[model samples]
Target chain A: MEIIKSPDALKAALKATQGSVGFVPTMGALHIGHKTLIQAAREANDIVVVSIFVNPTQFLAGEDLESYPRRKEADEKICSLAGVDYLFYPDVSDMYGEDEVSLIAPDVRGYILEGTSRPGHFSGVLTVVNKLLNIVRPDRAYFGRKDAQQLMLIQTMVKNLFMDVEIVPCHTVRDSDGLALSSRNAYLSADERGEALKISRALTKASHLVGKGVLESDRLYAEMLAVLEPLEVEHVAIVNRAFTPLDTVEVGNTIILVEAVVGTTRLLDNVWI
Target chain B: MEIIKSPDALKAALKATQGSVGFVPTMGALHIGHKTLIQAAREANDIVVVSIFVNPTQFLAGEDLESYPRRKEADEKICSLAGVDYLFYPDVSDMYGEDEVSLIAPDVRGYILEGTSRPGHFSGVLTVVNKLLNIVRPDRAYFGRKDAQQLMLIQTMVKNLFMDVEIVPCHTVRDSDGLALSSRNAYLSADERGEALKISRALTKASHLVGKGVLESDRLYAEMLAVLEPLEVEHVAIVNRAFTPLDTVEVGNTIILVEAVVGTTRLLDNVWI
Candidate 1:
């Protein structure tokens, strides 16, 4: 794999790539979830470009921007093993500068659930994704369903911005214990690690309830809150595919989401029913 | 020339165009100023696309957005004569939607003379321009140097966003009477139109002073303001090409700008020295 840092160097190499190019953007500490995105990109595109930048903008003040883990050598090893073609690791300076034009997320959709808890998060996300998409210019970009709201916002941005790229929404990669794979999982203590499973379990329960015809959003959320009661629950929301809150779950059109704190780490998981 | 009203149709037509495309975005009443941009685009690219949208977002509550001139048939005739390949005139619905994302200009650069007088104007210009640039995806885009701050902001947007297209800055088109060509001039009464010539004339005086090696910005602006006096002048300022205020003009990198009101019509003109 050719590891590039400068935007110019990466853009130069991109000119030579033929056929379809699939891009997978991530924040290092490569795990199984990231592997899934890379594998999908590898299978579909003649060239695969994966970028690892721990975006500081998405983190609200007093959040974990400072301590976000970086395992560059291990990530390089993983990319090599995963048949990745290009690994782009750009510093914060390489990405943003002072007094820059920024993207503000849609009012209603941008400031609810995760966005509500972490204000101005999606704006940061949308802005960086725009910069990355413009830089990569990939024919197809892979994003995990794990960050359902993030996935929805990205899909919205690409469509709204008139960007010509396909978003391949891969299923969320999970552990054998049903815990969603996240680089932040490393921050979880052993006991908190076990409690984080409740997030996924709550999502699974909500899905099962929906399968059993529990359409009312309140009943399903109550059931989820019950399952997540032992942990510190943040919010339980039922939203449409577009992230709009719905009173009732509409199968194939609704996502049941849950966010909770296990010790000091915040975890999120969702299921589309 | 084809007239495209919908975003999808315009994007499709853009893809079908051959070789380099030069885009000139405007808001109707096609004046010689727009023609200068179109002519430059025609010379540089294989196809030239012009969009006339008087974006509402860029207008303040008391601004003339509702009354902005819409000379459609005349604009079409002008484009046909100018050899424009496609003319896109998107309605408000086609360009924006409910709860849309916003582009906020940087704080410092966003709250200066023009931005101070017309708060949030550049935000709207940047937003619509961003949308147009993405949809058109032209190889080169044209802008007049008459709106010095607008040109600088657009250039900043393209560079900060890492957009690959070349930005072609064309000289401001002038009338036989030394008035800068503008769509808003249509709003001016004949007497008001004669009074508006002072803006350009004042800028010419500043340009001459720079040529003669008088570099003090305060003294230079004082001379220009004197020329603009006896007319209702809004602002007269001297700054570097980057739009940052300069105590003394840097001959090779200075821009002197003027904004004046003739009756109720506001006019802007600038010179890059």
Candidate 2:
């Protein structure tokens, strides 16, 4: 697990390795979700590269750019134990410059659900993902389905741009209580952590309702909203695989998503039916 | 040369070729200028790919996208003669979809010069260029300096995005009468063709003045404007290699650009000192 800091050095190092490469890009403070992505990358390719870049461009002005978790030593240990061939940890200066080119997310798909709450968030995700993909030039890139919209958009970007890398989406990893693991989970206080479980509970309730033959989107939304209760829920959307609004759940094609604020920390979770 | 109509086929074909690829992307109507670009690619790399895509996004609503010059058979023959290994010719449908991810050029640099007349032009250029580069995966891509600003922006895009390809800027090809070679020259009548000579002539005057050590940008612009009299000149800009406006030319780091409307057709030419 050789840790590389510069983009040029990573490119140079990649050129020396003659095999299929699998990459998992993360923002440090590695959780089980990130580990799942890394393990998937490790199993699939001869070379596994993990990039820990908490890209600043992805964070909006009021967002947690400064307070974002950064456990450098722990992240290095995780990558080393996961058998990562290269750990690319670049500074903000190393990745970006003044007056840089950026990407714009699609009008319809990018501005819905999560995009609605965070307007320019997907664009920032896309720009940094593009830069990382270009830098790694991986044969396959692994992404956890925890960030469903981001994973979908990245898949769209790769297809639209004709980028020559396969996008492998790993299933979302969660805790025993069903709460989706996130780096932002670090921000939750003891009582706030208990409140966050309602997010996963809401998603689970929606899945149970679907299993009991309740397929209508409105019914599912209503039931999930009841589960969310007095929490400041951002949205409870029941959409198909393409993120298109569905009148009724399409069984295997449906995904029930929920976002809620637990104290000051916003938590997200979803269940694929 | 193998003519690949689909991007998938081109990528598959390129994978079989075992060396560095040099690419030249054009809009067909392969004149001496395109031929010069292909020749430069042939001299540099193990494989040469030339794509003839008259990208519709780059053209504004009222612009001549429909009337854009295209000569398929002639362009094919030109590539064959120039020793091009592959010629990717994808349709608009093959290249784009209804909802797509796109690149946004740097605000300050992308919205000036040609961008002022045709807003959102560089975004389209950057998007298509990014797609083409990803599709072709060229080691070195060639561009003519006739579109000086475009060349600069593309270079900036490549650098800012951390793209791996080397951008090689070729000298602008010219006619015996000193008119810059362009596919759009096909739109000009005999009288308009003669009037187009004024664009190159103005650039020549600027270059000659700079040669004589008259470094003041204002004096050079005035002289070029005097030579371009009675023409619908868009702009006479004296700037550094980075396209930053200059009060005085920096000798080796200077570029004098001229854009003029020869009758109904817009013509562009520049001299790099």
Candidate 3:
């Protein structure tokens, strides 16, 4: 696997390659979730390019901008093992400049859910993702369904902007105990880690109730809230595939999402029906 | 020449084409200025694509968007004569949707000069240009230096966003009497058309002064203002290539810009050293 850093080098590499390109963009400290994305890209395309840049603009001032995980050695090994054609490890300088042009998220949908919890987060994600997509010009870009809102917004952006790339949404990968894998998982202590399972448990409970014929969103949400008792819940939303609020669930198109403060770390999890 | 109206058709046309593509994006009503851009594109690339989209997002409320000229028959003839391979003509519905993701212009630079007169104008221009550029994905995109600030801002956007397309700046095309050609020229009455020559005359005086060793920006601006007498001059700015105000002109890197109202229509012109 070739490890590249500069944007120009990656562009040249992409230009020299002949077949369909698949890209998986991430921040370092790769987990099984990232592994799944890379594996999917590898199987689907002739070229698999993975970019590992800790984009600073995506983090708000008071957020974990400074303390975000950076395990370069481990990330490189993971890319090598996964048969990545190119690993684009660009620095902050390579990605951003002073007072640059930005992509603003949609006013209404962008400020709800995860965006409401972390203001300006989706804007940053969309901006970085746009730059990455323009740089790579891949045939298909892989994103994890674990970040359901992000994946949806990216799909919206590509469609709205008329960008010529397909967005492949991969299923969320989780731990054996059902906790969704996240880079922020590194920040949790053993006690917090155990507490984090409640987020996933809440979604699992929602899925169980829905399977047993409870289709009303309010009743399902109330019962799921019971499963997440004593935790500081940010929100428990029941929405359709378009992220629109659903009072009554549609069997094949429903999504139950849960986010909570587990100790000092925020954790998110969801189940799609 | 092939005429395409849908985004999907343009994308497919671009995909099927071989060799370097050069693009010229305009808002219909093609004049001599647009001709120069197309000619440049024709000479430089193996294939040439031109898009005529009067993007609504770039126009302010109460602006001339409704009254803007639509010369589809004339425009098609011009493209055909200029040897354009494809002419992309998309309507507002084909270009925009409700509550879409957009590109926001830079706060400091984007809000001055043309942006100062027309608030949020550059944001609309950048957004639409970004969409058009992505849709076409040309090797080189041609832009007229007539819209000096717009050209500069587009260059900055492409660089800051790491977009992989070359922006070829074409010289401003002008009439024999020195009025810069514009689609809005159709709006000017015969008497107003004669008065518009002062804009170019002012730039000419500034250029002459600079050639004779008068480099002070303030002194040069005063002389240019004198040439634009009996007119409601908006602004006479002397700046370097970076759009920074210069006390003294830097030969080979200076630009003197002028904007004035001739009767009811507003006009803009500039000269680069």
Candidate 4:
């Protein structure tokens, strides 16, 4: 596997790929969720490119901007083992500059859900994703369904901008304790880690309710909130595939999302029907 | 020449083109200025694709969006004569949606000069321009130096986004009277048209003073302001190549810009040293 850092090198590597290219963009501390995305890309495309960029703009001033996790050596090994054709590792300086042009998310869709929770987060994600997409120009770009809102906003951005690349949404990977895989999970202590499982458990319980013919969004949210126990839940939203609030679930198109705060770290998970 | 209206069609046309493709994006009331850009594109690349989109988002609430000049038949004739390979003519509805992803210019650079005059204007310009460039994926994109600030911001956007396309800055086209050529120039009455020449004249005077060893930016702006007599001038300023305000003229690296209100229409012209 070729490891590239610069945009020019990435472009040259992309140009050399003869057929369809599948791209998976990440923040370096690769987990099973990222592995799932890469695995899908490997299956679908002749060439798979994985990018590890710890984009600075995506983190807010008070957020974990300074303390975001990094596992470059492990990430490289994971990509090598996952059969990635190219591993693009770019630093902050390689990506951003002073007095730069920026991407702004939509006023309505962008300001709700995860956007409202982490203000300016989606803007940073969309901006860096825009840059990566332009650089990779992949036939299909893989994103984990774990970040439901981020994936939604990115898909919206691609469609709204008329980007030719197809967005392949992969299912979330989980730990043995049912915690959705995330690099941030490393920040949690044993108790915090155990508490994080409630997030996924809540979503699972909501999915169970829906599976047993429960269509009311309120009931699903209520029961899921119960499973969340005494955790400081951020939001328990029941929305359709479009992220719009749903009064009644429509079997194959419903999504029950849960976000909870375990000390300083926040955990998010969802189940798609 | 092939005429494509849909985004998919344009991309396919782009893929079919051999060698470097030079792109000229305009709102198609083709005048001599647009002709100059087209001619330059023809000279630089094996294929040239001209896009005519009067992007509504770029216009403010009370701006002349609906009344914006468009000469479809004449535009087609000009493209044919200029040897354009493809003419991308997409409508406003086709270009925009209810919830749109947009580009926001940098706070400092965006909210000054023309951006200060018309709020949220550059964001719209950047968004539409970004979409156009992505669709074409051309080797080079051309822009009129008449909209000097727009050209600068676009260059910033392309570089900041790490896009592969080269930005070829084309000289502003002018009539014998020294009036900058613009589709909006048609909105001006014959008397207003004559008054518009003051913009170019002011820039000409500034250029001459700078050529003859004028080093002070303040004196250059003051003298240029005096030459544009009795006209309602918007701003007269001197800035470096990066559009950052210059205290002293840097000769070969300076740009002197002028904007004046000719009746109800705002006209801009600048000279790049």
Candidate 5:
């Protein structure tokens, strides 16, 4: 795989490339989740491009911008092994300037659940994603369903902006214990890792309850809250595909989401029913 | 010219065509200015697409959105005569939804001058322009320099977002009497139309002064304001190409801008030195 650092260079490279391009954008420190996304991209297109940009704009002031994992060599190896055609690794300067035309997330959909806690986070994600998508000009872009809200918003952006790329959502990849794989998982201590399992456990419990014919949203929320007991849970939201509040679970349409703090690190996991 | 009223149809149409597309986006009034833009596109690309969308978001509340002049038949004829291959004329519903992923212009540059007077205007312009660009996916997009700030902001958006299209800046078209051609000129009465000529005259005066070697911004501003005397001049700005206020004209890198209210109609004109 050829690693490209500049946006202009990537554009030039892609211009010469034939056939459909599939892209998987990620922040470095790749795991099974990122691999799944990359694998999906690899299977679908003639050219596969993976971008490892730990975009600074997506992190809020107090967020872990500095401490975010960066394993460039390992990420390169992963992309090469996964058969990536281009690995875009750009500096913050290469992607952004002093003043920029930024994106604003939809007020309603973009401000609920994850957006409520991280107010401007989706906007940052959107701005960088937009830049990346334009730079790659992929025929299809792969995203893991682990970031359900983000995936939804990105899909919305693609539709609303009339962007000519398909968004392919791969299922969330998880560890044996069901902890959704995340780069932030690196921040978890040995004991904190054990605590993080409760997040997936809560989501599993919600899924089980739904399987047992418990469809009411309040009941699911209560049962999940019990599973997440004694943890500083940010929210245990049960919403439909649109992220709109649901009175009762809609079988294939509902998502049971949970966010909790394990030690100082926050972990998120959700199960789509 | 083929008139495509849906984005999907336009995209499908363009997909079948095997050549470079040049685009000109306008609010339909079929003026000489728009004709100039379309003509430029026709000369430069294998296929030319012109969109006539009076984007509602760009117009502030209480603005003349409802009263905005739209001459569909004339616009069709104009596009046909200008050798446009496709004319995309999507409805508001076709272009927007209830909630959307919108764009926000840069705080400093976007909220000055025209943006200051019409808050969130550039954001609206950026959003619509972004959508249109994505829908058309042209090789080169034509924009008149009459809306100088708008043109600059669009260029900035294209650069900052790493959009693929080249923004071709066309010279501002003017009437024989030196009045800048605008769709909004339809709103001006005969007397107001004559008054609007002073805006271009003031810009002309500034250009002549610069020709005589008066490089100071203050001197240019004073001379332009004097020529615009007794008129309700909004601002007489002497700035560099980047729209930053200049102390002294940088010869090849200066722009003299004038905005004045001709009766109830607002008119704008500028000259690049």
Candidate 6:
């Protein structure tokens, strides 16, 4: 596959293509999760463009931006294996500059749960995503539901901004033990890796409870919290598809999310019923 | 010309057209100023789309948003006369919703001059302009040089966001008396209209000094200030095309701007050398 580094090169490459384009944006250290997104793009569109940018803006101060894993050589091999047409790898200078206009996330929906723990995170995601989307101009863009809130906010941004692209949400990929695949999972030790499973377990438990007709949000949250008791639970939130908190869970319109610190690594997982 | 009120209808209408589109966004009350923009659009592209939105976000509290002049019939007639293919007229609800993401103007450049006198004004302008640009997806969008700062910022937004549209900066329209044309000119009484000529006259004086090799910015600013005497001058700024203040005038790369209040009406005028 073709590896493009500059925005201009990618633009030139995209312009030369003559069919529907699909895009998958990611931060590099590819896993099975990323592969699934690429696979979907490969099957649907004549041209597939994947961007691997470790966006510094999305990471809060004192976060792991400095030490985020980078497997450039491996990533290039994976893209070729995945049948990618163009792999866009832009540097920081290629993406941002001094004195730039920025996108601000919605105040109310942008600052709860994940946003509460890491303020201005979604804004950064949105700003970079907007830049990428404009640059790529893909007919369809794939995003994993692993970041459910992020997925929701991005869809909202596309609609609100009147961008003419389809945002396809793919299901979250997990390990055999039900641990959600994340690049940050590299930070976890063998023990913490096992502990990370508790997050998904909590989500699975909440899903099972909902399947059995336990509709009260408070009870579902309490039961999930019990499963995540040993870990440092950041939040156990039950909300509608719009991310608004609900007193009672409504099946097919509810999502249960959990975030917990297992050792030094922060892990998150959610289930939609 | 076909008039479209809803965003979906406008999208459908735009999609049905199959050629380069030229867009002119305005707040109705069509005059020679708007006619110039539409005429330029008509001459340049196969399809011309005009949007008349009195954006509330761009108006500050008690800033006459509710009382802004809107001549719908005249505007429609003007568009048809100018050979516009479609006219988009969306209500506030069609453009905005609860808990929406927004665009923030650059901190340093966006908060100077007109932005200084009216805080957060450019932010609103940038936000709405971004929305309109994305919605219409025009091949070329036109703006007047009368609002010099606004034109510059919109150009900056398009460049920074990597939006795929050309921004054509048109010459500022003027009356026989050399007064810049503006819809707000409708608010001025005969005396106020006579007093408003000072703004353009100041710009003309600055132009004359630059023509005579007066290179110092302070000298140019002082001469312009004298021309705006007895008027409540807001600011007299000498800057490069980038809007950064310059110590010495640079021919072909300079802009002289003036803003003054005549009675209750605020008037602005500028010249690019």
Interface RMSD after interface superposition, each candidate: 1.1, 0.7, 0.9, 1.0, 0.5, 0.6
- A71 Cα displacement, candidate 4 (Å): 1.6
Better of 4 and 5 by DockQ: 5
Per-residue lDDT, model 1, residue B243, is 76
Off by over 4 Å in 3: none
What candidate 6 gets wrong by more than 4 Å, as runs, is none
Clashing pairs in 4: none
Alpha-carbon TM-score of each model against the true structure: 0.97, 0.98, 0.97, 0.97, 0.98, 0.98
Cα-based lDDT for every prediction: 0.88, 0.90, 0.90, 0.88, 0.90, 0.91
- Give per-residue CA lDDT, model 3, range A193-248, as digits (tens): 88788888888888888889989999988998888888899999988888899999
Q: Which candidate comes out best when scored by lDDT?
A: 6
User: Candidate 2 docking: what grade?
Assistant: high
Q: Pick the candidate with the highest DockQ.
A: 5
- Could you tell me the interface RMSD of model 3? 0.9
Instruction: Give the C-alpha miss distance for residue A65 in model 5, angstroms.
Output: 0.2
**Per-model DockQ:** 0.76, 0.87, 0.79, 0.82, 0.91, 0.87
What TM-score does each model's chain B reach against the true chain B? 0.96, 0.98, 0.98, 0.97, 0.98, 0.98
Indicate the DockQ of the complex predicted as candidate 2.
0.87
In candidate 2, what are the lDDT values of residues B159-191, reduced to their tens digit? 988898999999998889999999999899999
Scored by Cα lDDT, where does model 6 land? 0.91
Better of 3 and 6 by DockQ: 6
Q: What shift in Å separates residue A23 of candidate 3 from its native position after superposition?
A: 1.1
lDDT per residue for candidate 4 within B33-141, as digits (tens), equals: 8999999999989999999999888899998898988789999999999999999999877788876678998888888888888989999999999999888888999
lDDT string for model 6 (A162-211, tens) is 99899999999999999999999999999888878889988999888888
